[model samples]
Target: MKKQQQLYKGSLNTIIMKLLENHGRMYGYEITQKVKEITEGEMNLTEGALYPALHKMESEGFLDVEMERVEGRVRKYYKLTESGVKETNNKLEELESFVRNMQQIMNLKLS
Candidate 1:
């Protein structure tokens, strides 16, 4: 809905993985609400994109899943695999570097 949301698309996985890295496991709905709360609704992850990404990461062995029934509904929880933990660290470093580089470029243009 906002222009900044478009810029966030590329970092969705890093966001999700980092959250899981810190918070243990989480379900899809929980992940959505958490992101909204953290960013004050500036960033959102649609179910359409989220599930596919979760499945892809699972298939790639970056995430492991467990299903449980909560209030008569099944919920799938995702957590990082051993490889995923390592990847999260690498992703965080890359993301931080990108932010620093972007900040430098923006500061140059502003001056």
Candidate 2:
């Protein structure tokens, strides 16, 4: 059984971008599974959420998709464009700063 994760706001884009950066290219299901596995099943991404984000990123010119036949099915694999690499860097920096500010405001103490 997978543990339910608390809904953390506004980091999915960063997560997806970072995943692409490491993996080079991935299909949608693979991306979702990788995130869930890496988080030890904490984060389960829904197709509803993942597809829309992927489409938005595609529309934004941050991602390029290639279609390939896999097991008699056409799978769309997503890869980062040059702009995507730049965006990923920016998003990561933004997320890091946001987390830092949040820690400060919440007085998060790590032992």
Candidate 3:
């Protein structure tokens, strides 16, 4: 499970995009909590990693941010932009292909 969790680290961006694609919009902390809940505590996203990824995606034009004032503080929520949706679809297809290839290789009969 630890090894598998490491593999999941590479898919962080894809995971975030997919979640945003489904949920419409989410704040940074909310996204982290959601991942933790879905993974049942196996995967925890640290601030150092998650924030940089979000910032990079935002700069790449894959995400749009909406800032809201809540209790005298501003919260930034992220949602998929048009390009993000397209990128998410492409990434999902690529991930499926990669998984299939891995499965085939693992199933090879070698004496």
TM-score, per-candidate, Cα-based = 0.93, 0.88, 0.92
Candidate 1 C-alpha lDDT tens digits along 9-99: 8888899899999899999999999999999987888999788888888898999999999999998999999999998899999999999
Question: Per-residue error at 49 for model 3, in Å?
Answer: 0.8
Question: Which rank order by TM-score, best down to worst?
Answer: 1, 3, 2
Off by over 4 Å in 2: 1-9, 108-111
User: What is the lDDT for 2 in model 3?
Assistant: 72
Tell me the RMSD of model 2 versus the true structure. Answer: 3.4
Query: Is candidate 1 or 3 superior in lDDT?
Result: 3
Give the local distance difference test score of model 3. Answer: 0.94
Q: lDDT for each of the candidates? A: 0.91, 0.90, 0.94
Which of the two candidates, 2 or 3, achieves a greater TM-score against the reference? 3
For model 1, state the Cα shift of residue 108 in Å. Answer: 0.9
TM-score of 3: 0.92
Q: Candidate 2's residue-wise lDDT over 1-111, tens digit each?
A: 333343433688888999999999999999999998998877888898899999999999999999999999999999999999999999999988988998898996767
lDDT per residue for candidate 3 within 24-69, as digits (tens), equals: 9999999999999998998888888889999999999999999999
Kindly give the stretch of ten consecutive residues in candidate 3 with the minimal lDDT sum: 1-10
What is model 3's C-alpha RMSD?
1.3
CA RMSD per model (angstroms): 1.4, 3.4, 1.3
In angstroms, the error of model 2 at 91 is 0.3
